[model samples]
Target chain A: MQQSNVYIVTFSVILTVVLGLLLSGTSQVLGPIQKKAVELDTKKQILGAVLEASELSKMSGEEVFAYYDKRISSKVVNIKGEEVEKDEDGIAIIPENVDIGRNYKRKPEDRLYPVFMFLAENGEDVESFIIPVYGAGLWDAIWGYVALETDLTTIKGVTFAHASETPGLGARITDASVQARFQGKRIFDESGELQSVNMQKGEGRDYSDDAHKVDGLSGATITAVGVNNMLKAYMSHYSAYIQKRRSGESGGMAVLN
Target chain B: MSTETAQVTEVKKPAEALLSKRRKKLLSDPLVDDNPITIQVLGICSALAVTTQLQPTFVMALSVIFVMVFANLTISLLRNTIPSRVRIIVQLAVIASLVTLVNEVLKAFAYDMYKELSVFVGLIITNCIVMGRLEAYALGNKPYDSVLDGFGSALGYAWIILAVAFFRELWGSGSVFGVPVFDQISGLFGDDFSLATNGLMVSPVGAFIILGLIIWVQRTKTGYVEH
Candidate 1:
């Protein structure tokens, strides 16, 4: 049978319209579930950075959500460490909704940074603060959260995830052993200057005595440097808030705790 | 008279029509002798990439089977209407839409596996076997036959991948389906009975070597020789 130009055009248009409708309808129905999945995943990652390993492993999804609700408080702040109460239009801002990736494209002063405060079991005192940090790895984006002790200078824990780093080398950043090395590292010097954390190169180099350095991944120098830069860039943004807290001028701390 | 004859033909035994000898061949051949991955060497990229673990590999196989059957049936039904000049585009539209649906469903129900599989789920649109079968068989066959062919090819691809994953996970991690088999054995045989995992088996290179051996053994058993 002959297929004329008009026949081809009509067939193509109909096929395209039907497919577009089917795809859009599926997305519409599943959109909310996908959003929930993303939100839950973010909460899990945040908890992974601060919670005890034994406790985290035993908790289910509902328990994690309940824990998050009962113990975690978040607030949005700008680069100057001032809490942001509202946007330009006077609408209250939710810090958990602030996407770091999108905010990364904006100027540092204009970016909304989210800080998660982990409360003690009694919910009166702050236990730790988790700050999300992300930057480019060897191949693609690498991201993680760093949890700091109440002093806001000593590292309590850290967790890392990557998009497409080398499977055995750079991707090992997500390994528990690699992340455990960050424990006990201090981000501030004795004089109270922000030093962040350095990922030092060379194998078998003891960083036990160095409060500001951790051993780098064995075969991933570039990714290690990326992690170092990410930590410095993000930690510096929180320096003002940390300094204020250290000086006993905790007026701007979120009252929710 | 013509209406009465059509009715008689429709009333014939439905079982024979569903599982005729020719249809049985369509559903069974690809499991071994006419395997898509081993015999035709189609869709080897996913075969090598996702076979490092049994769980992900199993989910991937199910996803492929779903996409293949649906894509084949849809394409076969529209074969007559599709213009030769734009058939490839039409086929791609159908396959991509199905892959997207599968991805969304996976994200909703099995979020962790979905994350682990990641881009590979989206990569189904380019798996070659799905497109090849649609082009070669579905375009010229009835919808029922095309569906059978889809199932056969998917089974062929699934079994090979599952076999590869079994060996990879066992030798590489000393486990099966995430259970520490070797750890259990060592516990039973005292502390000295240790089995060091082969790191190479956990890598993509291991998948290649395992798949290559599978293809060789399968071909020899089936007495199939390449020209």
Candidate 2:
């Protein structure tokens, strides 16, 4: 090969080989950090479901951890309203990043855990907690953690999130303002049958403000309607557990209605 | 005996060698004339997917540029030694390594964007830009020319895709990077003015329309007809 050819060819071979190794090796080094980022984001989402983002934002990370530690206590409960072994039973294991279908298959009798958060709202000393709910959305499953007020109906606040939905449309299921509307909304009628809140289109009409309505995504009727339907599904399934807690049968920790 | 014959053959240019002018055409013409994918109808899948957002388009452009430049240079360097029987296998080996590196880097520093990019980031392995550069130019040219050729075609492809994404994000959501712009127009028109754009803008259908408009503009500007 000529002088110019040898210089460029040898340089090209060495450059490609060395650079490719470096790029691949560097990514492998960064994998753990990236994975940790994903885990932290997931933890934040779970925490947000129970606490208001505005309130959570007010506290530093350490303060938030301390607050959650003191305010929230978790216990495993049986189908018969009795406390199960702390180490055993179904455990309501929400797989950190897995889908609802897999998470749902862990039977209630296997052991479902309930967590209570003690706080005060509207001049009333209150105990609030979150219950996990799952249902279908427009293109996939819709799931959320709903934080309930002492009455176990009015939403204190909510944080909803989803996967693979249209960006500005179905994705609004996770938006802040939409979640705020669920606040002060009742989940059941006086008779104790599940009457979940409605998400209505156009200028929202608050049914009674306390047991009322939320404004639906204007152009995303299907996704809006999915959320409303799923709310009913969550409310009805969890009503039995809520009923026992309401009767003060699970101690005075939670008052349903 | 074999060594003497090899030494005798080393001094002469092969009769079958592609001339300099033709090699220049192979490198330069993809940007305008005889484009491998766009004009010649090759790798349209990526053209539709990543063009919905500018950031992804930028990443895709970077990936394509790296792959094209390196794939061409590597192929050109190995052109003399590679056996005719195994040349395609060798080409794939080089392309695959470049793509894996692209995936790994994106996965490392830009994890969120990498997740959003998903399979498309990995799909650069199959993107014909790498293959076309290898076969049409790299297999015969010197390494320097191959590198420039790779850069030229990748840029040619990127310019069109980024321009398409620019309009898609701007008109689709009336926002850039999720910040609501076009707020003035929306406010003036009231409810009649919709800044909350059609989700279709991010969808594949939007990409098709934008690409067509681009090709139409490019054609009109160049007065070229595709048969």
Best by TM-score: 1
- Per-prediction DockQ comes to 0.38, 0.16
The CA root-mean-square deviation of candidate 1, after full C-alpha superposition on the true structure, stands at: 4.5
Evaluate model 2 with DockQ and give the value. Answer: 0.16
Deviation in angstroms for B161 in model 2? 2.1
Residue A22 CA error for candidate 2 (Å)? Answer: 9.0
Residue B194, candidate 1: how far off, in angstroms? 5.4
Residue B44, candidate 1: Cα error in Å is 1.6
Each candidate's interface RMSD: 5.3, 8.1
Regions more than 4 Å wrong, model 2: A1-28, A50-101, A105-128, A198-213, A235-250, A253-257, B1-37, B73-101, B184-200
Task: Please list the C-alpha lDDT of all candidates, in the order they appear.
Answer: 0.86, 0.69
Per-residue lDDT tens digits of candidate 2, residues B58-92? 88988888989999998878777655444576688
lDDT by residue (tens digit), candidate 1, B62-147: 99999999999998788767787778888899999999999999998788888989999999899999999998888777688899
User: On residues A1-257, what C-alpha lDDT tens digit does candidate 2 reach at each position?
Assistant: 23356654665566568667876676678778667656545445556876767776677646665555555554544456565544435444333444444545666454354444554443235467666566677887777777888678878777776656676677877878778878888888888778888788754555454575777786678877878887786676567677877777457554432
